[model samples]
Target: MDGTHLFELVIAMFLAIIALHYLAHRLGLPPSVALLTGGAALAFVPGLPAIEVDPELVLVIFLPPLLFDGAWSIAVDRLKRHMFGIASLAVGAVFFTTVVVAVVTHVLMPSLPWAGCAALGAIVSPPDAVSARAILERVNLPRRLQILLEGESLLNDASGLVLFRFAVAAATTGAFSATNAAGTFILLAAGGAIVGCVVGYAWVKLVRKLHDDYLMIAATTLMCWIAYLLGEQLHVSGVIATVTAGLIASWYQHTVMSAATRMRGTSFWTVLVFLMEAMVFILIGLSLRDIVERGGGFGALLETMALPALAILVTIVVARFVWIFASDVAIELAHRTGLARSVPMGTGAATVLSWAGVRGVVTLALALSLPDAFPGRDFILVIAFAVIMGTVLLQGTTLGAVISWAGLRGTEAEGAPMTMSQAEAAMAQVQFAKVKSLAFDTDGNLIHPQLLRRYEHRATAIIDYAQRTEDYVPMLHAHFDVVLEAVAVGRTELIRLRRAGQIDDETLRELERDLDLEELSAISAKA
Candidate 1:
């Protein structure tokens, strides 16, 4: 395609992305699903150029930042608190699904290489973050259930990719060694983690030295790529490296970032991640035309492989439910037997977790990476695509109803308290006490300190909220609403100041951003 055509195509794709995304929001559907469906429809349009997505390019461009953003934005404290459940779902269930699918696929197609079956299994094992996030946004799931699902989605992507790499290598070389694979897994995970931490810390130091908001944002954009590239160069797992770096960066984000950096960087990363997701998913959908032609027509291939593909998909779904519920049972048994001190998993939580296994980008990338000569490559691709579409259309669309059926719609599930992490009462009190000092200290006139001094005692509610005082929740929301109203007033005045030439655009932007942050915090707290 010529440059003009390529440019036009890009413009069209972006416009489609925006329209489909808005439509998804209106319909309470996951944007990834909407984009994929739209891309498939676009594939059949006459005169549209055929678009091919390179697997390596997809991995390099999309996985790093998306993985990084997921890691960085995740609540680290919540991750730790829900470590056992998250780890079980992310690590144990992923491997279990891989093995189950591999065994089932091999049985269903004994002619295919065992290694290729494993590769296929690894490809389709992990539920995707993009779809999961969309559902979570629309659903009012219990916080505990949300953490389990989100954390699992985040970590399992890395685990699934790592496993996929090993499986693909084994398939390519026609060799299988569990002992060697296990050792390599440890080394890759350890080495990648080390590389990522080094890169993350180095990035923090560099941005601190530069001290420019735009530069800081630019550097963060590079952080994930650097970590992944470095890890790949060292023969370690780049997926793990990117995830680790993101976590490290997140840990120091508050300390390293100025308000401007935080505001701008957040917006930049959100857009970047969303765009990459749209492109990857749509491209996968668009490639359907090529795939159909390559496979001697979709109908013929579907007729031949439909049963096996359905079986593999069922294995993937069933294996997740088996592993998670079994883990839940084992944990409950342990707690009852006095062998573990942790809270036992509730039935609702287990059921909700069991039903949320939808696959996406990692599966697409892994399937695409299969060499043309590899055994059953086309079959693997068809199966992977089928699994993605089936799961999203079935499980992703119904996750909210599942949550409702499981009765995990509140902060507590099955009478089990979802203990939220408490803010340090002292620290919160100190922060809120300075509302006047923070907002109007520069003006020397606008608002008196006494006007907002009443906010000081607001932080006292922190410990109560932490302790799950249901009655106190409304009062807290009311307080945040009042504070938000003040922020709106402050924002209007700040804009007026800029219009009247009392402040420059830069000053107005910075101050208004501070108010925006204040309003955001208030709204977030209320949520």
Candidate 2:
């Protein structure tokens, strides 16, 4: 298709995504799932030109920022607190699922190469953060449970994608060695982490010197790409690299960014991530026809690949449950025998975690990325799509019900603590200090009692007062600076609370948002 056609199609798909997302929200369905359905419908439209995406471009453009955002938003302290459990699920469960899916799928489709099966397995092993985040916003879960799941969501893609790269290499080169693969995986992971840290350090240091608002925002996006590209160039795990950069950046975000910069950057990232997510789901749907055609058409694809794909889908879903439950049981046994002090999660929470394994854009992107000459490329792609649809449609839609059935819905109790007002209430000390410390202007002159009294009618400064008197503008700005200082103190306290385990990540962030607005309001007070 021509560039004009491609551009038009993109616009059309974007419009469709907006409409479907709204529809899904109204109907209480997952938005990502709705976009997938819409994309599939658009695919079969008569006379519409085919939309072909370069897999390299897709990964390069889409994965970096998404991964970075996931890394940046994840609570490092909570992640550390729950590290062991998160690792077992994010790393162990993913590998276990990959192996199980590969073995079972090989049995179901013996003619398909083992390497291809492994690649397919890896494709479906990781759950997408976008899908989980959407549902999570609508329902609450226990703090520990939410931490485990969200943490897993952040790191599993790295593990699964690393495995995928190995599998694809094995397929392309007709070589397979578990020993070498394991060694390389470890080396790559470590190298990616190091590279990511360096990249993140450089980004923060560079941005600290920048004063322009838009440049700072643009630099963040650039930093994500740099992390991914550098990792890839260094022959490490780009996914891990990007994620590490994000994590480090998030840790220092408050200290490094000006209040206005932080607020604007947050808004920019929120919109960018949402758009990237919407486009990815729709692209997968739009690619459905091509996938089927390459697999020998719809009827032939069903006849040849349907059963094996079904078998693979079931294997991944079941494998997650088996591994999680078994691990929980093993942990429980260890604790009972006094062999370990780590407490096992409750069965209900375990069940909910296992069932929440919904595949999404990452799986589809991996499948689509397979080289054309790779054995069973089309077949693997179709299987990946099937797995994504099955998990998302079946598991995503009903995850809340499962949580409720498991008696961990957290509908009332868990939801109340993460509120903005709660965060503000926690900052009563800082607020009091802010008011008491507001006696002096920028020149350190204590205002007369009458001057303060006349300005006491409002918490916010009146812009007209600045026009009426030159001294009043500077005085108000000085008060704004005091407000900014108060915000800084609030941030320090928020960080302290997070580190001391006094507040959960959700609450910390909610409080951070409250302070951000206060700072912005102070700036606007004298604008």
What are the models' TM-scores?
Answer: 0.85, 0.80
Candidate 2: where are CA atoms >4 Å away?
410-426, 430-527
Q: What is the C-alpha RMSD of each candidate to the true structure, in Å?
A: 4.9, 12.0
Model 1: residue 435 alpha-carbon error in angstroms = 11
lDDT of 1 by residue, 122-232 (tens): 899888876676566667876677888878877787678778877878877767787887787778889988998899889888977986889889999998999999999
Tens digit of per-residue lDDT, candidate 2, span 213-273: 8898899889999999999999998888988899989988888888778878989899888
* TM-score of candidate 2 versus the correct structure, residues matched by position: 0.80
lDDT of each: 0.82, 0.82
State candidate 1's TM-score.
Answer: 0.85
lDDT of 2: 0.82
lDDT at 450, model 2 = 54
